[model samples]
Target: MTSEEEGLRFPILIGDVGGTNARFAIVDSPDSEAGEPRIVRTAEFATIDEAIAGSILRDAPVLPNSAVIAVAGPVDGDAIALTNCPWVVRPKGMFNSLGLSDVVVLNDFEAQALAVIALGVEHMEKIGGGTPETDAARVVLGPGTGLGVAGLIYSRGRWIPVPGEGGHMDIGPRSPRDFEIFPHLEPIEGRISGEQILCGRGLVSSYRAVAAADGKTPRFTTPAEITAAALECTDAVAEEALAFFVTCLGRTAGDLALVFKSQGGVFLTGGIAQKIVPALRESRFRAAFEDKAPHSQMMAGMPVYVITHPLAALAGLAAYARKPDQFGVATRGRRWRA
Candidate 1:
């Protein structure tokens, strides 16, 4: 049957599952918008099923017939494992245990990519560069519990979400300061992937590395503490570390833009990006993003934006669940038939 003919059965459960928290909401019908998402701490539940049972099912107006869960990991095969969380999501098992008709799983960034088209100007803060090119490829990426990367391409009059483990790629130092700080991070991160210096744990690593490089002891032990110190200008090392982090993030974002030829834009999302907006504006983020020689002019014209919406992934999931074919996506999640 056509996806429209097989329209999403309501009430449908939609969730943006991350390492730290899971946000869920319910939509009454295919045409209706999803309700405000309720957030549940990932640490509160032993398994994803328990989390779902405690939040969406308990408070939802009615038990959902189907669900779309966007997770912070690769969605391949029947068993989906989260990268920074202990939750292992078995779709078939969830279908049986929850008595759902079907379950759809998506990489968190893939969900973010889908959200881009639905986002309004109020939902996004433009960082730099020119206006986005119509129908061109766009990239969405950011750092939170972990780094995420995804590409959105317009093909055949539809947007296609390209999901992959792009954050695990090796990060190379491009500046003198970056080169000087690289050795200290090498000991902690081994190979120095993008996630090594761009995530929550990576923030602490950056702070420690910056402190050690300057022959000082690190006072902050957590990413939050470091960000707080940096924002308040109470710690020089923390401030420098945060600056360095933004520069690296911009550099990596620029690389991804080139990789995908994302003239449409490069969107930044995730908790960390929102928290560090002031810092990003003050840092060398824009300069770093447009530092590609030979193509520096080309890079200069690519717009960058930071998505501010809290439950963007859920909106994307809702959209996909309602009309999968419209976005050039196949609804092939594990289904339960009894």
Candidate 2:
């Protein structure tokens, strides 16, 4: 164990809360491994309190002294609300309700950024041929219920996370096929954004758009159905939709890499990426990622991988909870500590 983890108090509660699920775990001490995470479907609970009380805390061996929660939204103000879920996470309220002394909330992608350093080759599947620069910036972004983006910069012997709402950025067509499908998306979303074509909802939207472009009617209403059909080659429109989705994801990922100059690498995570790994391996994804002129060579040299860890965000939150100063994460909520 590192010296940074030596000073943390025992029984820390950590969580990775997203639109679709809430995963929680407990670490007996900073130096000890976090326990197996208990996952709860977000739709089953009306509030964060109910989910926590009914799941992770229900059969706990001991009460936690502190907590760190990685939430899927911006975490700047006093009011912490999830972008896609109805739950609102208030630090002070949680402190009082859970009877915890300290609580720290982090943006979900920020947690992902922190987890990048802890990830090993075993946890990653390479998407392209490139070596990661040890000291440069690394980016992590992927589509799930929504698109999440974050960057990690190495400085002063530590990694700092940079979080932002990158998924909402406007996205445009890059290829002839993309152009053909663009008009169809405009009707679903007035102005197409990265999230419009790269997320779960986006997957369904892509199927509808591709079906219309192919002069056929869509039979799949959910992303899961479309993905299954596409993978099985049971529906031509679904296959086309999946291809389009992968290409758009690659284009957006490349854009993020350029913006962050992530020579260290780009790591893809989230539910959608994992489920569509086969589709992402197709040529279109890599081709689109390296399509930028004059910088195509530079882009090719940047390593890309898909993160396969199930509890990466939770582990990241635990890491930050152990040493907030090392990560440069603001521990404002710790002020509530008794």
Candidate 3:
């Protein structure tokens, strides 16, 4: 490991912190997998320190001295706040209070991007497209607490993760039916961003918009309710909402693929993508994805897969801890050393 890779000690705590839940595990030694994660609802605890103390430290077999965390928001300055959740993370306070030596935080999708390079075949379910080109640029995206997007590139024989707020990009109606429902979809900053209809609450809003378009009251108020009703074929409006959600996801994925020329493949990670595998495997997603004009043929040749690993983010963090030289992960701004 180079000087830039210095400071992550043995028995490190690795976590994937999102808006709704936080999953944590311990990497005991070199080249070992992260231990089974302890997942807890974010709202159940007031802060990250409290959550870790209550859920992980209390029952841990071995205490971790350092930590590498992936949070669902920008990691800058002394304090990092989650984009969707209310918790604020102060690395110095955490290491001090928990008796740790160091801490590193990353954008949630950046960890997902690293997970793509670390994960094997057993952890992935292919959705569409042809063979993935080895060592080529790729995209990793997920719709969960929010629509997260990141890119992965291979340069200087190292895998680098590029994380950003690609979820907030503008999305407009493409079809006659979309024209009807999109107008009803809620907007932030006076226009519809992808997160307006991609995340959990965003999906609920989409369902409501679908109902509003037809001048009918929505039967489902939550994403779970709408997804359950759609999967069971219990409600036509719910089904339509699911279709809209997946189609938009595919469109956005395709757009990113175009921008990055992601021939290495496009990976979908997060609870939502894993839960909706059946819907995503259907024709709607691939159809919208391959609908890119003039570049339809190019889009058809790129592969897309859904990550099936339950604790994928921790796996990524552990892999980097085990071999920091292998991945060109940017940890400078987020890393803290005592």
Candidate closest to the true structure, highest lDDT? 3
The TM-score between candidate 2 and the true structure equals 0.94
Better of 1 and 3 by lDDT: 3
Q: Given candidate 2, what's the lDDT at residue 45?
A: 94
Per-residue lDDT tens digits for candidate 3, residues 74-119, read 8888799999999999999986788888888898888899999889
Q: What would the TM-score be for candidate 1 when compared with the true structure?
A: 0.94
Model 2 spans with C-alpha error above 4 angstroms: 1-8, 186-189, 332-338
Q: How do the residues 186-281 of candidate 2 rate in per-residue lDDT, one tens digit apiece? A: 433477887788899998888888888878988989999999999999989999899988888888889999999999999999778888889888
Worst 10 residues of 1 by lDDT: 329-338
TM-score of each: 0.94, 0.94, 0.97
| Model 2: residue 303 alpha-carbon error in angstroms | 0.9
Instruction: Sort every candidate by lDDT, greatest first.
Output: 3, 1, 2
Q: Write the per-residue lDDT of candidate 1 for residues 1-338, one digit (tens) a residue.
A: 65422655778888888889899888878778988688999999999998888877887678888877889998878888999899999888877778787677778888899999877879999987898999999999989888999999998978999988899988887778877788888443468888798899898888888888889988989989999999999999999999999989989998999999999999999888999999877638988888988888999999999999887788788888777666865445533332
